[model samples]
Target: MCAHITDSVLYRHLWGTDETHALLDDGPRVQRWLDILAALAAAQAEVGLMPDDAARAIADHADVALLDLDDVAAETRACGHSTLGLIRCLRRVLPEPAREWVYYGATVQDLTDTWTALVLRDVGALVARELADIEQAARTLAQQHRDTVMPGRTHGQPGLPITFGFKAAVWAAELGRHRARLTEGRRRWEVAQLGGALGTMEFWGDAALPLLDAFARRVGLAAPDVPWLTARDGVAEFVNLLALITATLGKIGQEVYALQRPEIGELAEPVTTGQVGSITMPHKRNPELSEHLVTLARLVRSDASVAVEAMVVEHERDGRAWKTEWAIVPEVCLYSHTALRLAHTLLDGLRADPDRMRANVDAHGGYLVSEPVMRALAARIGKHAAHEVIYEASLAGRERGVDLRTALLADSRVTAHLKADDIDRCLDPEAALGAARSFVDRVAGEA
Candidate 1:
């Protein structure tokens, strides 16, 4: 019966976690809707808008398990009303007094919007916790590899020398910024929405604002100054943050996947027994988790674009814009949670070959450290003049298939002030990692 890949039992674990699914699944969502209705009744009574006994009756009998969901869906189809079906179904199960007060004066947006707020609130906390764990893992990696030398690449080519700690520190700092955003964003995203029919509380008379405040308090949310029936910016802001978080995760995965290549052999993702990388390649081990992080990030970003599109509305109520969230919200939630979970696992068990990284840095003879030789010669000769000499020598080295050290030794202009020993001293990979260790210390120290 499942149509979307997210709903498939076999594929669901790849896309979402059980903790997130419990919050977004249909049964759980309906139960939350019922809980919202009960809160509404209790608030109405607190503000003297409804009888206390009526509120109690509605609360006691509004259990989703007690109501017949089949009739609810059938009535939804028959009436073409978004919430009337649920209300009608609840009335069938409730006694007379509670039956009339089930939904009270609220509209569909009122119920759905508040539920959205509640979902964001819960998911926000989950995201914060997971992000903190990811940051910690990055910090650990950075500290452990503070002096682990590696070739820093640019444009897919090894350009210079850098410590592996520097790379992990960059990820840790970015994650820290995301954590700050999530902390500040909760206030804006967790506020309640209780605007009745076009956002004007004409039905509730003088008890309108009080009932709204009471309802928000009952549900552990802040009451917005005005109903956000059409203002979709809060939801947009929240999902946008999720997109940014996933993008950061994707960046980390990209590095891990690239460095895990057999040619590079600098980094390796953890592999356990019984895990198959490729069916045909018997000896191959693939970066499956790292690659999947990238895939998850792409899908979440696509969902984020649609979520932002939902910001444009016609008036006080635009099902066109708000209802798009019915698809976007859950997808972003599931994708983001699953991405964070995988990233944490990858980082925790990640393997790094310090010896391999050192070997790769030394693979190109002295070409990778040409900048050091260029800089040392620049001080003796002029800057641009030394660059031209080194550039020509580098070309000759490439054309003749000899290393930069041999080519530089042959040039009497480079040998006039420096010897082969000086070239060897400048070509040391550990010497080229200037300020890398200090930066790693700064980031890990702050941790």
Candidate 2:
């Protein structure tokens, strides 16, 4: 009966993690809302805006276990208001004196937005931890394959040699940037929201600012400079960062997908025993984890767009804009977490065929080292002229079905300055890996 794939018993594992689901699900969500209300009451009491005993009573009875969710839903549907149903249901459990003091001077935005900030704070920490783990895994790969040579392709054609370590280092560096971003942006997005009715907090009078700070302290978040009733840039920024992180994961997935091809065979995703790639094809090891990373990234990207769209709102409070976040934020969080999890698994168990990569390069008849040859010839003739010579030689060699060394040896233009030894040096894959190994070391050190 689950309407969305995120909630579906069968498909939920692919779309979200249990940790995120716990944070966003109705049971925990409602409980957090109650906790927030309790914190508000306690803050009001601290500011002398409400009675002390009422705050105590409210805090003591803030448990969500006491409320019937079906009744809450029924009342919500009947009243056509967002938080009133929960407020009324909460009052039923409170004593007479504390009932009125429960949600004093607060609005739906105050409750929901503060809850969102708390969610961001927790989710941000989770993401940072996951990213750190992923970066370490990538750094390990970079160190392990510091000299493992592979064909560095451009536009789907082999261009020159590059170490697999260099590729993994690139991933590690990008992930490190995301970790930095999360650290820098946490304060901006994890501040409390406490705007009442039209964001003025006029109902709370002179005590409003103090109460805001107290409420934030109770909830373990920072007090915002002002209530973000209309400014949704923080939410948008958080989701967009998630988009960027997932996109990087998707890029890694795409690389695995392309390199795992039978013709290429330079890399492969981990396959467990008895895992079936296809129902009909008996000989297939599909890239399910890698492909799913792409899928999760695309969905998270879509959710990020919705978060961005929710930034454009009307006046002090727009239900159209902020309400969209009620759905978009949680979805983005779930999808992003799932991507990070899968990416960690993929990187941890990844298989790299150094021999296959070298063979593929050799199969191209040393053409993958064309860049080094072009550069050596460029020293003799100007760069453009060397490009012309190499271009012509490459074409003729392909037509004649001979190695680049044979084709270049037959051409007077190449043999005039460069002998067989020079060509052999240029064709050396290690020699062609200019700065690749060093870059891996640099990135690994940074990581």
Top candidate by TM-score: 2
RMSD of each: 1.4, 0.9
Model 2 has how many clashing residue pairs?
0
Q: Which candidate's lDDT is highest?
A: 2
Q: Each candidate's TM vs. the true structure?
A: 0.97, 0.99
Give the TM-score comparing model 2 with the true structure, all chains together. Answer: 0.99
Q: Which stretches of candidate 1 lie above 4 Å from their native place?
A: 419-421
Q: 129-245 in candidate 2: lDDT tens per residue?
A: 999999999999999999999988889888888999999999999999999999999989998999899888899999989998999999999999988999999999999999999
Residue-by-residue lDDT tens digits, candidate 1, 249-274: 99999999999999888999888888
Score candidate 2 by lDDT. Answer: 0.93
**What is each predicted model's overall lDDT from 0 to 1?**
0.91, 0.93
